[model samples]
Target: MTTESSCPRCGAALDEGANFCGHCGLALVAHPSPFPPGVSSLALRERIAELTAERTNTDEVLSPLWALLPLIAVVFGTFIGILLIFTPSVEISLLIFMVGSIVALALLIILNYKLVDRYNKHLVREASLRRTMIEYTWTRGQERGTTDAIYPYVSALESIDRQALMDEQPRSPLWSLAFLIPIVGVVLYFYMLYFLTRFASVHDDRWHAFAYNIHLSSMVNGDMVPPPLPKYPQERSFILYLLLTIIFSPFLFYWYFKLVDDPNKHFQEMGAFEDGFLTATGRALTGL
Candidate 1:
């Protein structure tokens, strides 16, 4: 049951199990399709249509208000401290204030950690989706004779370290232990800002380059390609944030708010790209 074979690119005759086309010199790499066995592109088309039919952005919508949670503990401690002024037992009041502040701070830290962890997980899922979409398109391009125009896209997609994108594994409970010691907790708190700055800088550059190359390839290949992922602008200056924190400690809450709000905004922007991608993918599958 040998079916006739030919070059997908130049339409030249191909011998049995030929790996490369003799006429066009296109590399005939066999990429595994994401589609299930016996399923045609028609199924993919339906899926894409379904995706476009509704908002496909799945990133969790986190409110910036949650970032103000730490302030609740601050206000509570402040109220307790005011009691020291009128209390007959100064030592007892001091003990209660110190113990209460420590407990409140620890609880706030744990709660905020959970919020950040959830956000990072959402980002990881989004990264996986982006990888899947790019790989699917690359495979389809090979089948549809558009591999030459998509090579730059393939290169760009491959340049991104998948592990780095998925490295947002939820923090261990032991991480909160850093808050047990006053000096250590302060150091770790500042370190988090440093880490955030680095994270933003690295990912911003990487994704910007990836989106640029992906869109370049898409434009060159016309409607046959799926639309590129929209780039999210996420460059933040650590020095600026640090200075603001020094001037007014309350600004740290705003920084936390930015952490939640930025990704939500990114998710909103992605809705448009997702719709565009689904429409383009449907057209490509239909053409096939």
Candidate 2:
């Protein structure tokens, strides 16, 4: 009781339940629709391209040069201060040395404030991109007649969205100002570690869910299989971070460097995945 259908790629007569077309040998799968009703594949392709561009075009990336400038200033100031201690006029030397130290400290604080603000913006942008993609999948999945299959992913994405919103609510730029207090600086460090840990957990979960959804979508549409998900680097444990910081105060500098570097690495990884996705889905989408 098989019904004849047309081959999607070759426009040749297809035997019912055939896995491959004999005329042109294009693998066939019964996909309901490439996109939702009233949504053309061209629209989806354009939107995807837009998102890719938005992510790659940004200068939100933290650079080591900017991040470490505070340390460099401190080192330079210290050398100058030491030289001043050897000057002939003791009172003048002490006054100049103190002034120079204060200026260096002020510069350090300003750089740190700016760095934290940049990091926050970078994370928010990442979240926005993810939520947009998830919403895209949900909208298309529902209208493509595969809502049930994607429901779990939708739920997970929703949860991540809620958490992100909650996290952002209290993340004002003033949060970074806590570093101004000598004792509160320690608390600020711990808070940063906690935030990074939470981000790692949420980010890893999102990657898996998103990857699986893409795989399913490609399979149903008879498109090329997507490459494996990129692996995110493991973040250090909270306790270990505290222990290391206590044992070696210089570890804080290293931690700050990693904070600036990790997201850059993440962005690169995302770029790699986006390239693969665009390629794999091009043939499946019309006019792509």
> Which residue pairs in model 2 clash with each other?
none
Candidate 1 lDDT score relative to the true structure:
0.62
Worst 10 residues of 2 by lDDT: 27-36
TM-score, model 1 to reference: 0.69
The residue pairs in collision within model 1 are none
Relative to the true structure, candidate 2 has a C-alpha RMSD (angstroms) of 8.3
lDDT (tens digit, per residue) of candidate 1 on 161-215: 4645655444444444555567678777666556544454455456556555655
Please report the TM-score between candidate 2 and the true structure.
0.69
Candidate 2 local lDDT, 1-288, one digit each (tens): 446688766789988778778899665653343234675444565677677777744525667776676677768798877789688898888888887877776766666566556556656566666665555565556546555455555666667666666665325666555665687786884785566544544554555565556556545444454754656756557677678989997786776666666666666666777677677667655435
lDDT of 2: 0.63
